[model samples]
Target chain A: MSHVGYGCLMAVDREHVLRSAAALLTRRATATMDEVAKAAGISRATLHRQFAGRDALVRALEELGIQECEAALGAARLDDGTAREAVRRLVGEFESAAGLLGFLYTENQLFEGEEQNAGWSRIDARIAALFRRGQESGEFRIDLTPAWLTEALYGLFASGAWAVSEGRVAAKDFQYMIVELLLGGALRREES
Target chain B: MSHVGYGCLMAVDREHVLRSAAALLTRRATATMDEVAKAAGISRATLHRQFAGRDALVRALEELGIQECEAALGAARLDDGTAREAVRRLVGEFESAAGLLGFLYTENQLFEGEEQNAGWSRIDARIAALFRRGQESGEFRIDLTPAWLTEALYGLFASGAWAVSEGRVAAKDFQYMIVELLLGGALRREES
Candidate 1:
């Protein structure tokens, strides 16, 4: 294989390891570096070489999350569809990343008043802008602000994911639960 | 007061102590027993006397959560009002117990196959019945199930509470944010 192709393959492998570690750590936030390494199928030495320590590894995971989110936004094609449809596609995209989002959601709370990672804010802005565009185009309701809607979406997604994991709700219903609640409101609409 | 009154007061105090500890531990799950005692302003001995250990404490909290949820269901008067109004009241009651709810929201995941406390099922039944009532009355849309709506409400409440706590969203807007998003949705209304 060409050098560039080999490098790309290596980067993909690294990301796979990092994401596995992230999934494990998210469920068990206090997991040791050794356990994370084991979960990723990498030796301790290699894990240390890849990430200097736990904090460095988490930072890398955060970057990975940001990249995935950007990719989801692109894939959802927010610009092409109605805001409501866009949100549905976005929620579906976000379903896979729910665990990481849950971790970051709590982690941000631990250090109140500290600056949030800039990547998160950037992603938030992009999501918020989508909602704003929907409102402007008369596709969404005007009562709630784009900011609160964005936060609510994040919270509901985390809650729905956790609920499904706990068997309190069905796993297959995650997308339907979030989208229906967000778009249709829980109240029964009057039939014409 | 009479001896019986004094006994009643002591029982109330015990309940208070347990709740304060649960609130503290919900935010800091790994906090030591001493920390929990200090948080409740009770002696370590008293705390231990009430709850034999961390496991005991969590179990008590789980029971307390179940009871509180039942109380909320009663207080919300789910049968008397329209499902929309009932949900609004339900969300209002839940807002006050947001911390405990958030804690249970995560804790329930740990007991994978164990039977959940029966109180949750009862509460779910009440909420779901209200939604069904609304549907029959031509007040709610038929597409979404009452079960999903119930779960969605729980998710949105947790998310809204966390957002308010982190200062990402305002406390004053809690009710408005949740109700609007859950009821009216993000789509702009025709009249708006």
Candidate 2:
């Protein structure tokens, strides 16, 4: 392989290691730095070279979350399908990253004063915009604001992930649970 | 008032004091026992007499949450109203005790053991039954399980409370936000 191709592969490998460590530490908040490094399957020196310390590692995780959200939005084909389909796609993609999202949700609650990494705001705006578009297009009900819908989606995502982790709900049912509750609600629809 | 009436009043007052303390401490988890006593407006001795220690205080708080949830279930009039109205009432009442609920929600997450407080299970069953009733009566959609709907309600309450506290969302809109998102979802609904 060319030197440039090898370097690209190396960067991708580093990103994977960082994401694995972040997911582990998020679940096990008390995990020592050494534990995190070992969990990533990289030596302490190599981990340090990739991320100077725990703080740096967390920040990278935050970035990864933002990036994944953006990627999900793209893959969801928000523009091509009905808003309902788009939301289902978004929720489905989000399930893959639910653990990390749950970690970040709790972390944000604990550390409210810190400036949120800007990427979340951008993503929030994008998601909220989708809801607004649905409303404008008469695809959604008028009573709820887009802003609230976005926040509620986040809440349900976090809740579903935690419930699955605690074994209160089955893992396979996560996507179905969130999508149905969010869209059609708990009420039984009347037959026309 | 008669002796029995006086005793009943005193019992009510004592319960109120304990609940107030719980609400305060839930928001600030690290509050001292003295601070809790002061918030309750009772002397440290009286507070200790009512509850043996922090553990006792927490247990009482949990009991209070269970009772309040039962009361809300009764007041929500789940049997009479449309599922949407029932949910709105449920979320509204749940919002009042949201701080304590949030504390318990996070606490339950840390507790990996099988021994959940029985009161929680009772409350969960009652709420889940309400959802099932909605489904049976044709007031709610059937795809989402009653269990996940109940869990999502808890999660949204916590998130809404936190968001309001942090000024991300206005306090006035808490009920509106939770109900709207839980029912209508983030997508625009199609006009029939």
Find the candidate with the highest TM-score and give its number.
1
- Per-model TM-score versus the true fold: 0.84, 0.79
Residue B76 deviation, candidate 1, in Å? 1.0
Question: What stretches of model 2 exceed 4 Å from their correct place?
Answer: A1-17, A25-38, A41-54, B1-60, B80-84, B184-192
Residue A77 of model 2 has an lDDT of 76
Candidate 1 chain A minimal-lDDT segment of 10 residues: A4-13
Error of 2 at A109 (Å): 1.4
Give the runs in model 1 whose Cα sits over 4 Å from its true position: A1-12, A25-35, A43-49, A52-54, A111-114, A166-173, A190-192, B1-12, B43-45
Residues forming the 10-long window of minimal summed lDDT in candidate 1 chain B: B3-12
Candidate 2 local lDDT, residue A54: 77
Candidate 2 iRMS, in Å? 2.7
Top of the candidates by DockQ: 1
